[model samples]
Target: MTGNPAPAAAYKGPLPRATPETQPFWDGAKAHKLMLPWCEDCGQAHFYPRALCPHCHSVRLAWRQASGRGKVHTFVINHKAARGFEDKVPYVIAVIELEEGPRMMSNLVMDETPTPENVHVEMPVAVVFDDVTPEVTLPKFRPVR
Candidate 1:
């Protein structure tokens, strides 16, 4: 409820596996930077880093730092807990529409307990990094207060 969530001692949640395409993203997250893949051909940014641009299918892609600002396009209040998330029941899973024009799914961290009234569509948010492990830092979001 303060800022970024505290790192779990033994984080049971599924960790992200960084492949060649996503290594830069993971690295940037570790450094508290939100990096996005930009298509050199179309000059558009994209998420879920890939070798080829989803917009133009061009392999001419480059990594660039993002604004780390976005809005909650849509979200779900998960009353049910998935594996490794039992302690975080009633959490928020949101689709954030980044200012760069790409939407990405990530956990919406709240300064208060997550609830329907606490989160809403088009809510302004900024990226926060959850250092889940020494080697992995997951990018999450919190209300831009």
Candidate 2:
């Protein structure tokens, strides 16, 4: 099968309320790119779209395109999901350690059933864009071929 699955139903998930600081990030996602905040002072990358660098507390922040390659640092098999996720039972919620040295929390999309036996720590993953809506395309991770 192609890497993409059936289209999701109109993004029932809670859409991000984009502020000025986070609008660029959402815009990048809509374009199927991972844009991260980089600090000019310390020359490091960070997540969560903050104005200040978490490492050096510097206001010199810039947006850069990420490689979209990371490993599953940690994850949980969520047996129960919230409103928009009820249809996807037993899904994975994982923290990925991007090659750029920043960790981002996102969903894990597997080819087959996701079990503890198949999903492991530090498993290599790649980004796949799921266009939940016309304006929002989420970046989910899947095992690398």
Candidate 3:
């Protein structure tokens, strides 16, 4: 299947639960924007939003708009299906190193069949949003053409 898969009715897969620290990130995704928590003290960006900066251990954090551009740091092709991913076997799960300097794990959606030849380390990618539900949107990546 090319591009993003069609949204299923009553999505049976896992969904992210927004916490107080992560609400902004989810809000940004819902708006089709990639936002990251930036440490005001060390000027570093981080994912999996938390109360303190992972780099400098500072409480001074702010939300910043990310370029949504990154490179595949590493990845794996999943042959075994997860709870809601049976139809999507052989999909790629990648750790994307964002240009802003933090790495995040997300699904790498491809326009073609996923394989070792199609996906590799250092592959350039960009973010795409999947509105699985009215309340939740997922940030996935696609190869940058």
Candidate 4:
């Protein structure tokens, strides 16, 4: 399994991947917006952008703005930190269920420390950004108002 790059505060990780097909997703993140690919054929929303619609294999696709509201589906807390994030141990990593039906993996922020015990599955969250690097901004999540 692959994870997106850790933030600049945790700069030891590689930069997040932004392929030609998925550039728009990251571009929206830079502007602190959540955008995703919508299948023109099936008329549904999807993530981890692809050239064609994953459901119908339709080459014609379009992008739609996301609601940015989701629920935590699954998660783990990194008690043993990675290289760059050694200082911020015990952070919450989550698989969030977007209202539109797609699930995304990201961090839960604005909490003192996010943990499985503290962060429950099915908890509502909203998109937030951490300008981790000058060129990169992470679309993390926090408890939604």
lDDT of 2 at 126: 88
**Which runs in model 4 stand beyond 4 Å of their true positions?**
1-10
Ranking 3 against 4 by lDDT, winner = 3
Kindly list the per-residue Cα lDDT of model 4 for residues 32-127, writing each as its tens digit. 889999987899888779898888888878888898999999888889887767766878889999999888899888446764557888989998
TM-score head-to-head 1 vs 4, winner? 1
RMSD of 3: 1.9
* Steric clash pairs (candidate 1): none
Full candidate order by lDDT, most accurate first: 1, 3, 2, 4
Higher-ranked by lDDT: 1 or 2: 1
Backbone clash total for model 1 is: 0
- Per-residue CA lDDT of model 2 for 23-137, tens digit only, reads 8988998888999999999999998899789899999999999999999999999988878877788899999999999999998888787899999999999887887776677
Residue 113, model 4: lDDT of: 70
User: What lDDT score is found at residue 103 in candidate 4?
Assistant: 89
Q: Give the deviation of candidate 4 from the true structure as CA RMSD.
A: 4.6
lDDT of 3 by residue, 1-145 (tens): 1344466685777998989999999999999999999999999888889999989999999998999999999999999988988877889999999999889999998767898888889999999998887788889998997
lDDT on C-alpha atoms for all candidate structures: 0.90, 0.87, 0.89, 0.81
* Clash statistics: count for each candidate: 0, 0, 0, 0
For model 1, the local distance difference test gives 0.90
lDDT of 4: 0.81
